[model samples]
Target chain A: MNTLMRWIGIAVVIFIAAPLVIVVPMSFSTAASLQFPPPGYSWGYYQQFFSDPSWLRPAWNSIYIATMNTLLTMALVVPATFALVRHKFWGKSFANLMMMMPMAVPHIVMAVGYYSYFGELKLVHSKLGVILAHSCLSVPITFLVLSANLKGFDLTLERAARSLGATPGQVFRHITLPILKPGLAISALFAFIQSFDETVVAIFISGRDAETLPRKMFDSIREEADPVIAVISTLLFAVVFAGLIAPSLIKGLRRMAGGTPSK
Target chain B: MSAYLRLAGVNKTFGNFTALGHIDLEVEKGEFVTFLGPSGSGKTTTLMVIAGFEKATRGEITVADQSLAHLAPQERNIGIVFQNYALFPHKTAAENVYFPLQMRKVGKKEGMKKAAEMLDLVGLKGFAHRLPKELSGGQQQRVALARALVFEPDLLLLDEPLGALDKNLREQMQIEIKRIQKRLGVTTIFVTHDQTEAMSMSDRIVVFSNGAIEQAAAPLDIYHRPATRFVADFIGESNLLEATITDAATGKAHSPVLGEVTCGAEGLPPLTDGQAVSLLIRPEHLKLSREPKEGRQNAQMVIETIVNYGDNAVVIGHAGDQQIRVRVPGADVVILKEGDSCHFSWTADAVFVLDK
Candidate 1:
């Protein structure tokens, strides 16, 4: 009876995730517009997404924005997280609340706010404008993730480094930065995803010159329900999905190779 | 010669909570001084303040006569070993030792060569390529010590450096650390709560309690002539009996447990003109006897309980309504089972006066 209930629970989860799984095969549709059951299987939309520079340019733009936003978020968040975790100071709680404030405010509202705010600054249709807009959303999540990671950090290691003749900067560089590798990598990847898959923020702040791929996909879906959007969506999902599974894959491979995972 | 390092009127506070209060200390070069205390007694906190991790709220700290108040930990040129060893998980054993030199920006080749030599000194030469996790806990600790010594700092601060090891490993590391510190001739300050560890390693011990220095002296002096009631209670096992000064200013007293006795101290209010005071007597100093205690060799009691702890026996006995313990040692020592009666007696000089 327990096994049957377990199977039923698993089936319910799969049923809830039906739409997401169904969208992947739609990218193979033979017809122009997206339809249920995909009409028939073909690589036409996929080829179109890669071949046409109109779609290609936004894809490249998305790549650039994601990379730059992730890097910028890391640069800002890592040190801030370090200070928040490693040092005691006044207004620390206030700083933490501000860092996590973005996660509380609805992104659509912030996008609207940023849209008007940047437009006043004459930054509405620029790459720097979108970069700044996306960064606002990305940096908070990056800081939150990295902060949680830093909580588990053995602060004694930094002290040990200092006692061994490491200046404050050297301790951060040698002891802190290297041990924070896993957290940094994970945060950067998630930060990239946070900006890459975001449609609402891109819709309000993105411009003709700085049109991100998600905004482009939104435009295509709004104008003429294109199957190519599904293709790009599936490709984006595949990239993120692979990232989520890579660590597990390596662990599984290690087990298969008869090597114990060393702490 | 003067002491190598000293903390004169060193005080520390975290807001209203006093962690260490007006601590005065000194340790000669090549001499190991252990700060012994219970948790929250400011032992590890004192070490951190010395290492510049925690700034003293007031007063001054000096290493070989140089003030260290404003100096950062790196600039103070002190080596520290934490309880956890704190080896960088990402680095190989050799790299861990080389980190200090690398931080000081020594050339890569020289740093690696010196780190290799340190690893060899720690008896971990062949394991240099292994990561910290790849080695045993004891080995990781050795690597940490080697790293701390890599820069050859003027002072070494150890915060319960052997605390994380098992009994056998801890003992082994204690000797290894002592040997290394001796060879290096660094003024070392060790902080630990374990009395046995302090007694085994330190040339002298500073006992702290309630944010103050309870006592500071050689191990034997601390054991024999503790300055306060707290020190005697902290350092070893003992029996404290309420007494009255029968002959004030003549080193004579009358303990309620065993009657009149001669001591080296008198003239305190609690023991004034036959007034009551506390006299602390070490359990081992009291011996078990079959005969009754008489004049000048007076003070006799009866055994209450005997605890056999493999190597020795602890016999707790009653003498005139007061309980006392006698540490009985021998291969064929008579083990007094619980509720079995026996006699107890000790010298008056073994009784210490606590005038409260």
Candidate 2:
């Protein structure tokens, strides 16, 4: 039974990691097109991805749109989460449902809706259109993260601050914002990742001028099987993996240096 | 001199549910008062109203002859130490203490120096840089105390600050808090349901029941001379026997369980003849003996349980249908046994009457 269970675990891990194993190696392949095995390893695709204006412009566009989406999403979600988590009023349940509506509906359906809706607003094929759509899509997960943090926040701290002579605005600046910094960072990261990786909505609204990286990758894959797509995937995976482990890596290095961790 | 902090007919209601019902209280300057009651009895609610968190539906609070009506909590200049400590996790001990001063726009260097001095006063001298989670529970409690006091606010309200600590640590912090409050001479209000904490710390204790103040007096007075049956029963372990005053002049009362009893304790309320009242006999005041003792109010009962502490023991038994508890010295426990018929006696001086 133990052997069978161990085998099952190994199979599950392999199935989950198969994409990374394939994409990472294919990224370094010297093949002219997307192919595996019999292809020699080189940095040719990585060089092309960095040097090509076609790849670089969309990458920069994705970054800009994602950054704007994050800012706009946080601006909308922060206060909404605080209200929904901390207060109750008429139609509160409906408001809560509306906040999570984007997550419930299919992404393709949302893409189609925005494609026409933004077209009428004369915003389609513009960076503003993609940013606005991504912000709406980012709301649910961002709200979930922020509301969970807000709920766990001991309100007594705010009360304590007030008693200690901090005005309402001062309390937020000195106590609430500082304490919620980590949660806010994580939620904003989620928003950025969601916008940067959103393909369907970007393909619909982000036309030639405002094309995001994911839409560009999709177009390129359909037109020609570009190995550069694998390079981009590999680079994004490395960046995200580094971000996830950076905190512990820094802590470990500090420990090795005989410096105390700041809890 | 006028009272330092005063609440005149303060009442709070949440829709239909009354949280505080016509609370009128006065605390002299530099005096330590405690609001003692069970959960939902509105002790904390009164504190919140005073702190401006829960606005009173009616009535007003004044400190130093100034009405706190239009003042926000920040303008009121009151310090509070919460039950959970509520220390800023991101700030060090010194920084936490410096927060109030920073709000007053004190410079960083000077505020930090003052904060360190305050931390030193709380016996956390060298822990200025430690985060709250890095310190022990008692240390966190001291940091909270220092932070609350560093601003030198007009009032300090501690909401059951020692409730989360272990017994030994709780006792230690109690003494520590009392010492700090004394040194600072801040008019402090500590809230707790723990009767012993209220008894040991407060210059005066305001006992709450339901939504009103049952009685407010010095600790011993509140304990020995509780104004109502609820105060008698809640403050300490007591055998509250239902009785009727038979002679108002002689302090005599008749009880179904203990028969005729004389309530001659000093400071007892004036009783009228045929008045329905309760005779409160604290368990420690009752003496357990094998035979009916002479010149004392004696009652016979069958011993059912003996709960032994290290230095003392409580002998619980029944007389007719009423349960009687008698606290005896640990040395006397060997002479008593369960199922043995025993006599519990109290003198006239120990028998206090509650006419409520």
Candidate 3:
């Protein structure tokens, strides 16, 4: 049974990793078009991706929009999550359901809705429009992460701080915010990545001035299958891999510095 | 002497449910008072009200003659060690203790030095750098105590601080806390449901029941003279007998099982003849023998059970439908057995009378 389970796990890993594995090799290929086994290997595509204005513009736009989306999303979701999780009021369950509504709807459906809705607001084709749209899309995941953290938080610590002579604002600064830093960081990271990789809504709303990287990549793949797309994919994959592993590396470093025996 | 802390008619009601009912108490400087009661008996609620976490619906609380009505919890200048200790998991012991000093604008070096000294007072001399999770329960409790007392606030409130410790460790912490409170001379209020803890660690105990104070008195006084039947039943083992006052002046009361008995008249309210009352006989005050004893109230009972505690044993028996308990030394249990009829007697001074 154990051997069978191990084989199943290996099969699952290969299934999930096969596409990613292909993207890295394709990024290093000299092919002019999509191919499984590249005709040859070269750094030509990487150079093209770096020097091209069309690609760089969207990459910069994505970074700018994602950063703004993260800030705005955190500003709105942090307090909303606190209110939803830490308080009892009428229509609370309904409010929680409403916060999660954007995530539940299909992205294509939201794209259609935003195409007309943002058009009416004259926010289409702008960085502000993409940021506003991405902030909406990122709220659910941010709220989920933050609410879970807030739920596990021992409120007695706040009370203890208050009893120890900290005002409410000071308690938040000294105790609540510091203790929740990791959760807040992870939640903000999720919001940034959510907006950076969101393609459907960006394709519908971000026309030329605020074309996000994902929308550019989507159009490139559909039109010409640009080899630069592979380079971008590989770089994105490397970033995700680092993000996944950084937490454990940090924990290990902290343990070594503390020098205390673990339980 | 002027009271250091005063809670005057403080009442708290959550919607329709009353959590504390007209709680009025005063504590002198450097006094350690324990609120003793069962769960949901308003002991913890009273502590919360004093800590300013729960606002009293109707009354005033004052410290050093200043009313605390408009003050927030932080403005009250109080320190509290919660039941679970509530130490910040991210902060080291020294940092946890240094927090209050830091808030008061103390410099990093001086605040941390004061924190280390407070840790030393709690007997955790070198544990300053360890995080709360790295410490054991007792160690964590010590860190919490050091943190609460380091600021030297006007009052210290401990809400069942030793509830998590083992028996031996709890006893040790009880003494440790008492010594620290005395050394600091901080007006302290400790809350616990453990009667023995209240007896051993408190200058006075306030017994709570159903959102009201049952009685507040010294430990021995509460044991010897409980103000109500609930107090009598809660504080210690007592065989309460329903009786009627035969003569108030002579302190005579008549019970079904033990006919006309003499009781202590000290502190008893004025009683009329034929008035219904409760006669309290503490188990330790009763003597057991095979025959009736001379110069004391005597009654015969059949032993129903014997609970031996090595040093002493509680022999439970019944007399004509009335249950009676007698506490005998362990050596004396050799001659007694279950189902055997025995005579139990108590002196007149041991019998306490309570009016219904």
User: What does fnat come to for each candidate?
Assistant: 0.91, 0.87, 0.91
lDDT per residue as tens, model 2, B55-123: 999999999999999989888999999999999999999999999999999999999999999999999
DockQ of each: 0.54, 0.72, 0.65
lDDT scores of the candidates, listed in order = 0.83, 0.93, 0.93
Q: Which stretches of candidate 3 lie over 4 Å from their true place?
A: A1-15, A29-44, A254-263, B265-267, B334-336
Q: Candidate 1 lDDT, tens digit per residue, B1-356?
A: 99778888888888888888888888788888989999998888888888999998888888878999889988889988889888899999888888888877898899999999998888887888888888999999999889888889898888888888899999998899889888888778899999999989888999988878888889988888778878878889988777777777676777666677777542233346666667888987777766655632545566677778878888877777777777888542564566656566667667778764
lDDT of 2 at B227: 86
Tens-digit per-residue lDDT, A142-236, candidate 2: 99999999999999899888888899999999999999999999999999999999999998899999999999999999999899999999999
lDDT of 2 at B238: 90
Per-residue lDDT of A1-263 in model 3, one digit per residue for the tens?
99999999999999999999888999999889878788899999999999999999999999999999999999999999989999999999999999999999999999898889999999999889889999999999999999999999999999999999899999999899999999999999999999998999999999999999999999999999998999999999999999999889988998899765465
Q: TM-score of A-chain in each prediction?
A: 0.89, 0.94, 0.94
What TM-score does candidate 1 get on C-alpha atoms?
Answer: 0.88
For candidate 3, the docking band is medium
Q: Interface RMSDs of all predictions?
A: 2.7, 1.9, 1.6
Query: What is the clash count for each candidate, in the order shown?
Result: 1, 0, 0
